[model samples]
Target chain A: MADAAAAPNADQYEEQHVHEVYEQIASHFSSTRYQAWPIVKSFMQELEPGTIGLDVGCGNGKYLAVNKDVFIVGSDRSSNLVKIAAQHEPHSAIIADSLVLPHQPGRFDFAICIAVIHHLSTPQRRQEAVKVILECLRDDGRALIYVWALEQKNSRRGWDEGDDQDVMVPWVLKTGKKNPMEDGATEKTFQRYYHLYRSGELEADVNAVGGGVVDSGYEKDNWWAICCKSESFTKASG
Target chain B: MKVLTLNFLTCAVKACKSTSTSFPLHPKDCEMVSDTIEPNPKLLYNILPRVNWTALLTTVAELGFPELPPNPPTIEELQADEKMTQELHTLLLETQISEGCLVCGNCGHAYAIKEGIANFLLPNHLV
Candidate 1:
């Protein structure tokens, strides 16, 4: 216990804290994340039946079942989420670091990484996460990635998409046992690190991976991007 | 875990690069459980084209399962043999690695599967 807190660099600190948040919130996260976003579903539906796919940062593996046609192997950092994912697609999900996916290059036809990259606490790490997803794909393979957007005007929670890009968001859990309201008291809040992105950040990162973005737009307070490892795109961007 | 599922996996250590052959993570004292999933022969027929037949065959045998054919059946062959398709489905989807270790062939890194979950997290030194 002391060793865990003894020393951790910026990356390790973020990793450790994120893991804790997910471990605690695994069930709550799944309850809210029961359905795949429409755009992501459309993307999954477009894939050919036999196409091999990877859902990097797959939380609860909702999209893994989107297209029964594609054999999607889901991977998440949290073992809890992986367990839920495995329940559906036996042996599909694995507890893995997104920056170091344990699979071969050019192994998948396409991939879906949703609401994942925004969790990285730094820009360099954000880049590395994006790089890892692209690295997992074939040269011609495509990936649909999503990140939380700063322009959250449409958000129901009224989350302050504040001016500062890097921030910590707190999630309040309902303990189910209602304590009498002695006073206006705040529920216990769990902090989750996030690096909120502006409009062009996701696009630039995709282009930084060398003009890999086929299409990118803001939808529902999130940045949605379609990236591919096209031989020509890489050459042109490089 | 199903042998065919192992085909796409590698040791999750950060040091292990993509070029490394991550498959055949040796399962030692593997506890297998049988599960029943509705068999869809059509899906199996579609999957064979993408899978590396030999890798799966070798891994399955290594995992101590009844040996699958050396070469995967052709589309027509798979469609005709419902029993074989169901068997493949059972092996891949129903047979769960309830608890065991998947040791990497090259790295000797042991990834543990406990209670049907595979813990692919590596320690700091390994990362």
Candidate 2:
């Protein structure tokens, strides 16, 4: 009871911080996020052409641009990121929150929520994001989701060396970072909310949300998992 | 937007806002261009399984490229004829919808596509 009273609404905190951090860093974020992680590229490349794809939290639309053979609809909460993504993605890129996706249920055979879920502040909210992602997929569809793992090699990976799972990670915007839209404007440092996953935490939370984790493992410093809407859950939803 | 992507896109209007009713939005007054690329018959053959044949056929016809066979090619037929597979490659990947409006079958919302960008933005009243 004390814990409940002490904690601010997790989703609301995430909603406020995530948007602010991204909006401020949208320009700098796009410049560095040029290449798709090799794992992500391989996953999309394997899909057949004409597959219906959705890139949830599609920051700067890297997946949409690289995997041109399949038509992918892109979405992001930040309007600035969506606009930048629209420049590369040849189709629809809309402003949408990850919690409430824009498309109908079962509309996508292929979906990816990459580098997005770790931004959610609370455990329950993270699980809900995973559930919402699965709901976006058809019963036969597949999803690839990645979150930052607690096991980074260098300095303590998540937060200042402690038992706390939730922490705010800061992004340092180098002074005089090349401004894309305008010339010679410097950017400032910013901190973003993150809930770093520890090993099976991702798979467990997803499973709790009725999402079936087909494959899960650590890739580099991230906990990556592939999921699908299970048959039983599909029938129940139907 | 590619014609194949149109297979998935549908009217996002308020009324037909579900998997059952909103899908395969009609591409009305769409202008398109077809590009040529190296023929990858294997890729084309693999793509055969996922194409929503009826939706694609109707959508492509509406886009003024009524060249696809009335019936989709069987897997065996596609594997046997590389040229047919290559043609399908052109249809699915190369064709681009540069300008037009996608009309919703359920609620009469026309999503405009200008310079290859589909505007899914809804008016304030709709929101």
Candidate 3:
């Protein structure tokens, strides 16, 4: 039964659905045809050694391989992805929600919610999910959120944009269950794209929530921002 | 009778528990004042969607702190108070009621949180 406070439109990616998505995405990774590995490598370079990290929506554990020294816990809405992640990176992986994490508070030093926020249909849900992630972190913990910023004015949907765009694709409710491997099983329906962040919006949101942006920029066709919880925000006010 | 009171009581109890501090209210208090106080109006804004405000307020007032904000707070008032931020953080992020009760603001349903737990169990009425 759905709780009264739970968002009606949000879909919980249970273990089964997650597995199917990962199994399909895994095959693509195995082919070595995509440039995803290098991007994951660059992301790993910025981490502190032995940091407890969470890879929210981590697909297939490709990034895990590069950060073997860090205690990385990979979570995905899709069970298929969780399975693949566990199989590939046995040291770290779990099936969990991006919006409502099952772990205890302050469990991690860093969290990476990459390539997931845009999939949500509404900004309210996205913000709530972000708030949940913030709660999951310790006072000094950090997060790296990579989202689909706006595409260049004349460029295609996936085209790389040097600057963030305001437009975001909308969510299209699927009429029926989608078969992961079948072509045209799911359609790419576009909703109004969210206005991509101007350079300071990421920092501003983090600041409002008592956090600070450590690093932010676009790379390899996606907008990436890293933020850390500010100690001053947690101090009891006089 | 109102659920918001119970929610506030539960929240206050949980908040007390989080910091390992004991509140003045007790279980016996839960039964005594359950009938007297009106739900805090500020609770509507503070507890909506996240808290079972009606139940919490009822329970706490029953336990004794009957002076909960009895009305929805103004935007200006909410912004001016730091306590609101702290309270909201605890109410939304800290309190985890597993079996006591879930009182909805919109529908005014007093869902049970049985056995020291607040059940968010949805009944068949919603389909």
Candidate 4:
């Protein structure tokens, strides 16, 4: 039997629900007073003048208000968030999916994916989303991505307790724990979070896809990674 | 007059050979030009798997070319429109730098292609 959170179409429902929640949050937090302002400001200070930038999974247009001079486009999957962004920053916001941006290749100088990767149900989806975003950048463009850390303090509870065969969330089988929701339920009902990098893992992943980590740091619960396309890596692969 | 003519001819030959071997500008400039004329489309098609159609069309238009065939090109049109076909083929296959700059439609990053090379280096903080 399917768990409540793992119904026949649970993935679809979860995706929609996440977007709906974001919409509600965006409406209330459209102002600069929101917490994302400082992060955005820090991110913007490093940018060169007249540089093109993108705000991926940009929930609202708050960050855009401060950096109107730079060419900036804010995109989100949620129609409501996109509407809010358009209202706040007309002609600069787009309704688009992060996993498949509707833009030309090498179109952006920089891309910022903020506080959205962990929310993805699986790591494969998260990686795929990164690939799609990378495609939108020029050969030497940079990407600033923020994802939930898999560190000890940041790791969520109830993550590892499912069938060993399941690859989506292997943490669920850490100790042969049973599914919390129902008996004989093959589907796990835990909120998933990726484990912290075990030295070189992050860099390896980035290098594997022709990217190099230019900078990395952490703020509170979020781990930030700044990466640039490796021209040599790409050239060699080509 | 015969001696003078011979001297002039010899000087012309030397000048031609010297100019062919060495550029008037810096050696680096010559290198830049050589690198600029990169592998054309025929050599590049096998390496590049994906091409952004919209960007290709926009670039061709910016270069004073005609608009692209609609999303999907018709066989009849492909057969009849040689220019369109050639443009499409070049856009799809060519690896040469056709333009000097690219403006991001979203973020407006002005990527300058100096000497046929695009510099996409971002500051440490922006990365």
DockQ of 1: 0.61
Instruction: Give the top-scoring candidate (DockQ).
Output: 1
TM, every model: 0.89, 0.73, 0.49, 0.49
Deviation of model 2 at A81, angstroms: 4.7
Model 4 chain B scores worst on lDDT over the 10 consecutive residues at B1-10
Task: Compose the digit string of candidate 4's lDDT tens values, residues B1-127.
Answer: 0100011111111122233211111111111111112222322232122333443454445445457654645546556766765554444323233235434332333434343333333233332
Model 2 TM-score (B-chain only): 0.82
Q: Per-model TM-score of chain A alone?
A: 0.86, 0.86, 0.67, 0.68
Better of 1 and 2 by DockQ: 1
Tens digit of lDDT per residue, candidate 3, span A89-111?
Answer: 21345445566453445646678
Candidate 4 local lDDT, A152-236, one digit each (tens): 2534422222322112332222212453334654443333323333234345556666676777776555567777667353332
- Supply candidate 2's per-residue lDDT for B41: 55
Question: What DockQ was computed for model 4?
Answer: 0.01
Q: Give the per-residue lDDT of model 2 (tens digit) for B1-127.
A: 6665676565555456654545678887878876555564554565566667878877777777756787789879987887887677777767877888888777777878766657675664554
Name the 10 consecutive residues with the lowest summed lDDT in model 2 chain A.
Answer: A1-10
Query: In candidate 2, what are the lDDT values of residues A1-238, reduced to their tens digit?
Result: 1122135776556656678789878888899998788778888888766567788898898887666556577878777787788665334466666766546678677798999988876667788888877877878788899988777756455333244566667787765545432445565557687777787898898789888777778776888988888736433321
